[model samples]
Structure formats: structure tokens, C-alpha cells
Target: MEFKLEEFTLGPSIDTLKKCKKADLVVIAESFDVDVPVNINKQGLMELLIDKLTEKGLFKEPAPAVEAELGALAGTPAPLQALPTQTGMSAEELKLTLRIREVEVRNRELEVEAMHLRLKAIEMERGAAVAASPSATQSPSQSPHDSFDVSRHIALVPPFRESEVDSYFNAFERIAATLKWPKNVWSLLLQCKLVGKAQEVCTSLSIEDSLKYDVIKATVLRAYQLVPEAYRQKFRKCEKTATQTYGEFAREKGALFDKWCQACKVETFDGLRELLLMEEFKNQLPDKIVIYLNEQKVVTIADAAVLADEFTLTHVSVFSSPVRREPVSTDRRVRSPNGARRNVTASASARETRECFYCHEQGHLIGACPTLKRKGQIKQTKTPAPINLIQIQPLSDKSTKVVESKKAQIDSVFRPFISDGSCSIVGNEKSVPITILRDTGAMQSLIRGSVLPFSAQSYCGTDVLVWGVKMSVIRAPLHLVQIRSQFVSGEFQIAVRPELP
Candidate 1:
């Protein structure tokens, strides 16, 4: 790419040597039109030419027929909206478009580099010319108007970008990658960069009329969000720290908000006046009075005189307000106006069965349940869940042992891991044994990742909508023979693998 320096020292505005020699004599009063050729210093000449030909405003090519462009070039059906809205785009087309976009990005980058080099060359040329000029002052010059002194590195800036958001992101990514950020955090940072670039380009291309700083703000938020998640230790470390700071700020804001009531200069402030008449408001503040409406407790400012259309002191103290209860007519301190004590009033009517600690039901403990008692059912002793297990919830550190033994009684069932070297699994239709791995790292389950066939019903459901297109599910039952079991030695259950399950 040829990088031209418009308005350069040698640009079209370059004054002939005659003009400078004539004009350099302290602007002598000239007769009529100047017969002498005017000479421009390299700096002034470059500036004038650049100002004329350089980008005044971004120009975008006329919007293409988006449908034809996408469908023909990208090989994806274009949605009604230019932005991607549906999954009509096949995976192949998506990959191709991504590649094309990546290439386009590189090309634009070269263009930017070329422009930068042009600017640098123009600057260097002016510097050389100024040094060579004999009339130039030998004394050192200082820019009295410039307040800011620049460093070798440009990164000292805070709200750095006056244009081009990608500058910030590239710098951010460069820093983060150099530090070797954790995988999750790196992913988030990269995504933020991508979105920032998208927004930046959208504005440059005039696709969006307004490109707010929301992109940068969101990137900062996502960067912070990924921190605690990636570095778990900091989650605990900063929890209390942030909480304390927040509390202090909230308290200050709360105090300031209250001052607004007293400063009310309005002549007739009925709400604040009424609120001040209330006993609670008189003692505390205008916002402590509590009332209930539609099962929700509402607090308002008690200083009725300061009540206004915008804010309510009514809800100020709602959090600490007591629930209003109906007055008790009967003396029921000993009983519930019947025979039982106030605490035990609901019981002693019917033979209420005690709940089982094991089964969590009144009828039976897990030990007596058919699931565990069945002859063929494999029973498992109570065990604390393993940290690296299928269950998604965070595990409790505390442990409690069950006093009463509970047994599960169930029809014979089998779960087996099939690992000969590679993987081959077999199962019956109903209750098949399978190692269900839970990956919190993953956003969704890969049902197809499992070798087992999905149930026909599952395939037909809305959940199986493939790429937003409805697809049918296939299901069937099969005996799992190759499965291995940790629960039972040399034992396996006939697992089921539906065609679509």
C-alpha cells in the first residue's frame, strides 16, 4: 500500500524558494500582487495538504442487498434484520464468514498502519527540514501553551482513546496475555474486546448512528466479573472488603438524602408535616412510618410536610418496621383459646405422623422403602458426596452422621462405565447405569456426546430443535453388556439407549 503524505513539505503547497526569501524579511509591505514566489516551510506545507485531502468524515459504501450478499457470498440465508437473529446459518457458513471477517480485519489493520507511517514520515521530514534551514533560531524552543508532557509510552492516559476503541482492547489483551491470565478470565477479556471492536467498527461504518461508551464500560465490568470466578481465593478476600466500602457509601448517601427533607423550602408541604406529626417520625425521621397494602409492607417519610411527587419517605424504614397484627380478644397465653399452649396450638388434633429424618416423609424411613429392600436392588451406604462429582451444587464443609440407619429398597438397577480402552456402552430401556458428568465449566450438556441413543420422546420435544429447525427424536431400549460397575463387582444393568436419547 502506497502511503502518501498529503500537505507534506514536498506536497502541492510547497512554496518555491523565492516566496520564503521574499516573505522572511519580516513581512515587508509588498506592492500589488507578489511577483516573488512564496516558499512554505516544510511543516506548514504538509499541514495544509493533509488538511485538504485527509479523511473529513468516514464514507461507507452504499448498503449492499444484505440477503443476496449473505446468501450468495457467505452461503447463508440472510435474516430480515442485518444482524444475525437466527441459526439459519449453517456451521460451515458461520466458519467461513468468521474466516472472511478475520481476513478483512487484518486488511484494515494494514491500512491503519500505513496511515500512521505516513504521519510519522511527514513529521520526520519537517524535523529534518527545520534543522537544515539556516534562518531557524539556534536557541531551544518551548511550547508554553502545552500543559501536558508526553512520555515515551502513550499508555499513561486514563480515558485513553479519543477515537478507535480497539486501541484500548489491544493494549488490554496484550497486558493480560503477557501476564498469562487464567482460561476463563482470558475468554471473558477476549469477548469484551470483540464486542468493543464490533461497536467501534459499527460506528466507523455508520451502521450505528450513536456509538456510546457502553462497550468500554461493559468490558470493564466483565473484566471485574471474571476475576473472582477465575481466582477463587480473591472471592473470599475481597468479599468483606467490598461490603465494608459499600456500607460506608450507602450510609453517607442515606444521610445526605435525609438532609433534603429539612432543606425543603416549600411553603405548603403537607406530607412532611403529616409525617412529622406521627410519633415514630417525630422521634426518628420522616421515612419510618410503616403500613401494609396488598400483602406488601410500605414505609413512607413521617415528616408529612416534605412529601413530594417524586420520592416517598414512606418506604425509608420499611425494612425494620414490625408487622401489624390484629389484637387478640381472648386471653390465650396458656392455650390458643382452646386447650393447647400458644406454641403447640396446631397439634394434638389428629395423630400426626412424625417425619422421617432419612426419607423426609411421615410414612416410612428410606430403610423400609421398597427401593432399598428389594432383593435385587443394590444398596449403598450413606456417603458424603465427593467434591468432583456429577452434582452441580456447592458441597457443604460440615458433616453430620445419621443416627438411624436408612436403606434404599428398589428394583434391580445397574450403572456401569464402559471402558475397554476406548468406549462402548450398552443398556436396557428403563433404568440404565451411566456416569453423568457435570461440567460447570460447560454452558450446556452435549447429549450427543454420550454414545447412548436419546429417547424418542426427547428427540421430538422442543428442546431438540436443531439449529432452530424442528427435528424428530428416535428412541429404543437395549441391554448394556460391556458396562463396568464400581457399585457392584462384575455386575452391570441392562441400560437403555434410545435412538435419539
Candidate 2:
């Protein structure tokens, strides 16, 4: 395959330069009015002519495609053809011919080497040019490919809500514009980025179906429509009840209107004001106030507001300024450090005198008395020293019976159980075995309700030393209980049973 430089650089702008023959290319270059070489071979002649034309700026360098083809040709050598019959050739002439052929091969090799270096230079220049272009300064989102992460960018934006469809869609449109996404893909991207109820409505679709932005908008609108109109109906029905003040009624109606507007995407300021005034004049306020307002011929919201304020001021006393009283301290009496009670009737001087413990002076006491100091009579009184008592005959050698009680090292381990005061209290009604769980920390003992109506003679108060603390207990007498085939006295504590209603 052969390609000419003029094909891409200066030849007619058309696809597939192979359609034009070499002779036609030559003719085209000659027609450019440059001097043409008469004796050069076809390949070399064409290269030289192109170089001259490029130098004169009549033709540009070849395109990258042309340069690639040139490089491939440089790497591959032309096939060798058989020489004509050499029957009459001398030996010396044949030797010279062989030398010339060898030199031509070396020249072609050198040309190929030079072509490679030229191609490398051209590639570096192209790269530098692209790097310096303004388009290189664009952000990833503005790039002409799928380079930016769409999901990550959308995550920063707020999710859409059924009530806030208009605002959400408007913001979405701005985002899509900034991203420069095509219209066909807008709906698909929105569906992918949907959240909340909007996301639930349009679950993810396949890429083929996701491209329909119209379908996505329709689906979202339909979902929004399905949102209940109960708020709107409530707003319409809202009125000032007999007990509700004008301010309270207005606040309730305003709140309901705001909710309805948000759900319905009703954002016009004039429309909202008109709706509020119409509802107020038509149904909310009292008939007398309405008739008075009509008599005054009030029309605008400003006039209606003035009338409402006037009516409230005249009829509602709750909004009037409250009568304030003088703040008085409720404290009855104050005590001085010297145990003197100073009531509210006491004068400041009397109170200060009461605060003085010794001389009854208002400003200074007997110890801190300036008058006594000036008189040189404020002497420090010495306190009596405490006498030390010696130990008398080692506390008289009090005799104590030291009964040695053996404390066997019982290595018994048991898991602690929490008792909910539901254990059965079986007294010695018969010689049956009964289990007793003793909690030394229990505040009171529990008794079964069936063994109620305790006898007054059986109850006795006793202070038992438990865990080094004297704990009060109520001991009651029980019938005889046998333990290990021996009769032992059994006793239970008296417990109160709650009376049933």
C-alpha cells in the first residue's frame, strides 16, 4: 500500500486518497504553481516537492493518519526484482553495478531512520499543542466522555419529596444543565438519583428504558397527584371557633394553608394572600365584625388587617396590657448568727445590732470593736486548757467470757438468686419439709396472705444484730415444727396484707 503526503496535506479534502493515482497526485502538486523536478524518481521526487511546498506554507504537514502510513512504509523495504539477462556484461561493470546497488540500500536505510525521528518529533509537538489548549482547563463534568461519577455528584444534592416536587425538579433541571447531559438521558439520571417517595415510585429501570425523561416526569407527577388532598380540604374548612381568639384562628389557618401550598406547589404570593383574605371574610370572622367591615367598605388586605386589629382591641380584653404589681419578698424572718430573729418590722440598725454577738454594736462586734481598741481595753481572753486524764489501772481488768467459736473454712460456692418476695411461707401446720431462703440484707420479711389475722399476743418487737447493724424485727409464735425428727419451736413474722376493694 502506498500513500502520498499531498493526499492529506494539500490534496482535495476527500475520503480514501488511494482512489487517486500517483500521476494524478503529481499533476495536482504541479498545478499549485511550484517548480517541479524533471529527473527525480517518483518517491523521492514527491517527497522533495512536498517539503518545498510545506516550507512555502502552500501545504501543511500531513495528518497523523498519513504520518503513520509513511512510518510503516519506511520500516518495510520494496521487494527486489530480478535483473534483465546479463549475457554481454563485463566482469568490472558487474562489480560496479553491485556496489551501486549496495549504496542505494544504505541510503534507503538512512531515510527510514530519519523518517522515524521526524515522526517522533511530530507526535511530541501535537501533545504539547493539546496540553496548551483552553479545552484542557475544563472540569471533569464538562469533558466529552463519561469520566465524572454521576452518582457521587447527585448525592450532594437534596433528595426530591412529593410535597416539594416543583422545587426539586427546578433544582434538578439546573444540575442537568450544568452537567450538559443530553435530554434523552436526563430522565434516566434522575431515576437513578431519586430518593424518598420519588425513588419508591420509579424504581430503577434498565438503561434502554431509562433514557425517557418524559416518562420519568410523568411518573413523578402521577405519584405527586396521589398524595392526599386532606390538607387542602382541612384548610378550606378551617374557621374561628367560638372559643378561639382571632390570633389563634389566624395561626391555625396560616399553618394549614402553608402545608397545602407546599403539597400543591402553589407559590404565588398574591394568590396566597387573596386566598387567605377570601377565607377570612367569607367564613372565619364574626358576622358583626364582618358587617362592620363591609360598612367601612374595606377591600384590600391592608384594610382588612386594620379592621381586624381594631375589632380585636375593642372586643378582646385578653390581649390588653396586664396590671403589674410591686415585687415584694415573701420571706417572713431572717436570723442573725447570734441567734437573734430579725423580722421585716426590724430597722436596719436593729438588724445590724442583732448580728453583733458581743457588744451589740452595729458596725463592729466586741472582738472587732474599734471603740474598745481605741480605749485600749480589747484584751484577748485566754481559754481554760483541757486537763489530760491518765488510764486508771487498765480499765479495772474487766472480766469477759471469751467463748471460742470455731469458724470452719467452708469453701461453698453458690449463685445468688433474686427473690421477688413470692416465696411460700409454710409454718409448722404439719411435719412437712419447708425451704427457707434467708437474705441478711432484706428490709422486711414476707408472709403468705392465707396465714393472715395475726394474734396480738404472738407479735413481739426484737432488735437482732445482723451484719453488725441492729435491725428491728417483728417475731410471732407458731405451732411446733419438727426438724430432723426433733421438735423445735417455729416462729413467723407478722406481715400486713392489703385489703381488696
Candidate 3:
């Protein structure tokens, strides 16, 4: 179709180009001599084509409506002949031209709308600027130095504490920043919230010093003894309170430690701060845990704390109660002389029939035997079995003679047969089955030294009296054991008696 140069110069709108497929857009860009890459997508090709066309002056500024201009030119006289000749276009070219004109008109309308939006934004910004200006809010006669009523805002500040001067100041600074309170008046505002010793310190300051917030703060902190040494002490002694969560306690401890470092001016040096923290942390731990951390050669406070926590967890688990065991049967089975098994109610019938070993009496155990008490008062003439002697060496010949004489006297006293039971001692690697004697007269449990494993380290020395003879014994640490169908765990004294069967 034939077209005027003016028609071709007016390029297609972005919307029209967007409606075309990637291949069609590429073809159009090639016609306009735009350098569009072969791999470019439809939208990218369209943008490149429009930019190239505009740079080359192919897209002209849109004129007034083409339909009105054409109608005005086409008079009633020879209108049909003048329309094609004057425009120099066919029906199809005229339709294409009219479509291009329509697109340009729409683009102009969008540009005008955007301009109006930009103007609105600028006006809104100016309004906001005016609203925020102090001059706009205040009357001409009002001075800029007028005092803000901070007393009304005193509720926003947390109450000052004599013990927590640092914490109170931190909270007050944050509240002041939020309220936009002048720095010069911060001391005045803070004074309203002070009480007790804090208020006294503020009042004692000179008027000039009181007006200076930093001066007032320093004086108050000094009065409360919140110095570097105080912070160090607080950090060292910090303990988790019952009501505080673990996270909260950890944060509080960290804050105190930071304060100590800052006050001492060692915060810039990590090595010094870490050393101080590690020492303080070690002091709070048990001696054993501290030793373990030292053995691990921990370099940082965090690593030491982690190791200590792991050790604590493992230690606690060792003492914690084992899973709930099913109730054990109190009933016992007795093998009669005829080789027949007979069920015995050990908890009821057996207890009623049982006799005390000391008195050979029913309804009571040897612990409460009346005859046993009399035996302690009335010396027995019967010779007792040779007692196991775990004696400590006497310092002198006279003391040695006295110990021998005491042993001879104890040999004459009557000794009673004690009840015994069998149980296994569980260790990290293996279990050792050992027989345990239940001495009703003795106040503590005792075991043979031979029964304990060589690896066992818990040894507490004490003198135990068996019958009338006093013997030295080593107390072993707590151990878990399987006693019949149930687990038993506790500490036991180790008596070094190889002579006993």
C-alpha cells in the first residue's frame, strides 16, 4: 500500500508493539533498522525498537485529533474527491494513520496524568515540611527556648534503683530519645524519677552540675558505688535467679561482663577480656569441672562454658533416677525339705513368723531387740569371734598398748549374727557381684575394699565401730547396681577387712 513519509515517521505505540509476537517485533525492528539482538525477548525488542526510532526522529510529536482536522478540510462540496487527494492515502493507509494518531493521543493523556501525580507528591511533601517546622506550630510571640513539660512524661521513664544505676540510665536514655527530650534537660527529667539514695545524690549536686546530665549521672553512679570494681564483682558473682529464664540470665550476665570490660577499658583488647571472662567463669564452676576444662585446653570463654555445661549434664544424668521399674513382687518362694516349691507371703505371713536374730523373738527385727540394749550395759563373759581389725598405727608405745587392750576387751563381748544380701556394683565397663552385710546396729553401710574396682576413686576415710572394736574404713563414691529385679544406687563405706569370710 502507498503511504506518505509523514505516516511512516509516526512509529507504532509501545502498546501496539507489545501486542506483536517476538518474531513479529523482530521483523518490525529490522524494518526500522534497530540493532535488536537475536536472543532478545518481545518486550526487550519492543523497547529497543522504540528507543532507536525516537533517536532517529522517526516518532514525531502527536498533533491535534486527525478526525477533526480531516472533517474541517473536507467541505460538503466535492468532499469524497478532496479526502483521498488532500491526504494522499488509500482507505487502509488512512485507517492505519488514524490508529497511530489514537495511540499518540493516549500516550499524551498518560503523560499529563503522571505530571499531575508528580505535582501532587511535591505539594504533599511541602505540606509535611510545613507541619514538622517548629515555627508553623508556635505563635510569633512564643520563644523557641520554652521548656517542654517533662514532668507529664515522667511515667515513661522506669523508676531509678540504687542497686541498678546502670540499667536505669540505659532505659532512661532510650525513653528520652523516643520523646525527643533536649539533652540539657535530661538531668531535670531524670530527677523526677529518682528515689532514695539516687535522689539524695542528685540534690547534693550543685545547680550547675545538676543541669549537666553527664555530671549528675556520674555522681549518682558514684554514690551507689557502681564503679568498675563493683561491676567486676557483680559479674563474678552473678547467679541464675529462680524466676529468671536461662536466656534472660545469660543476657544479664553478658551485660554485666561487658560493663566490667568497658569500665576497665579492656574491651578493645579481646584477649584480655576473654582471659578475665574465662577466670570469672571458672570460679563459678566446681573444681572437677574446672580441671576438666583445663585438661581440654579451652582457648575461649565460650568453649569453656560449653564444656562445663556438657559435664554438668552428664553428671546430673548419672544421679538422675532410672526409668520407672515395674513393681517387684514382695512374695517369696521357699523350697521345702520334700523338694516341693511353696509360695510364702514375705511381706505379711513371713514377717509375722520371723524372729529377731538378737533375742530370737517374733514380731520385731534385731534393730529394736530389747536384749541387744541390755548386752551393751551388762558386759558379756562369752568369748566372741576374732573381729576384723582395720586399725590405724598408734603414735607411741603407750597408745599401741591401749589399742591392743581395747581389742582384747571387745573379743570378750557377745556378737550377734547380722542379716545379709547379694547385689552387683555397676561400673562404666562391667558389673561386679558382691555380697553385702546388713548390720542393724551400725549407722552406715559398709563394703569390703576388695569388692570395689581399681578404677574407683571416691575415697573418704572414717572410723567405724563394729561390735565393740573400732576400725578405720574408706568410704567409696556413689554407684548404680542391680539388686535382684530392681536397680539400687548409693554411696558405701569400704572396710579393708580381708580376714572376714
Candidate 3 TM-score to native: 0.28
Worst 10 residues of 3 by lDDT: 75-84
Better of 2 and 3 by TM-score: 3
lDDT for each residue of candidate 2 in 1-501, tens digit (9 for 90 to 100): 465443333222333333545575565455445565666565665665556655754343333433334335444322233334556868887667655544544555664455556657878999998988856677765534355556656564556666667457768888778877667556656776677767776775555455577667756766666332456677767976534567998999998777766654556877567545654553445555656675775546677778877987887642222324433223345444334554433233433444455555575335456666666653553222211111111111133222111111111221132111212223324332222233455544333323333443333433222121233323323321122212223343423322210
Runs in model 1 lying further than 4 Å from the true structure: 1-220, 223-317, 320-501
Stretches of model 3 off by over 4 angstroms after superposition: 1-145, 239-252, 265-267, 270-501
TM-score of each: 0.17, 0.24, 0.28
How would you encode candidate 3's per-residue C-alpha lDDT over 274-384 as one tens digit per residue? Answer: 767776777666567877997897758999988988998888743232334443335455454334554633333434566899789996557457888788757754332
Q: What's every prediction's RMSD, in angstroms?
A: 35.2, 28.7, 30.7
Model 3 RMSD to the real structure?
Answer: 30.7
Candidate 1 lDDT over residue span 422-490, tens digit each: 123323433233334333343222222245444432232222111111333323232223433343333
The lDDT values for all models are: 0.35, 0.49, 0.58
Q: Which candidate is the best by lDDT?
A: 3
Candidate 3 residue pairs in clash (backbone atoms < 3 Å): none
Ranked by lDDT, top first: 3, 2, 1
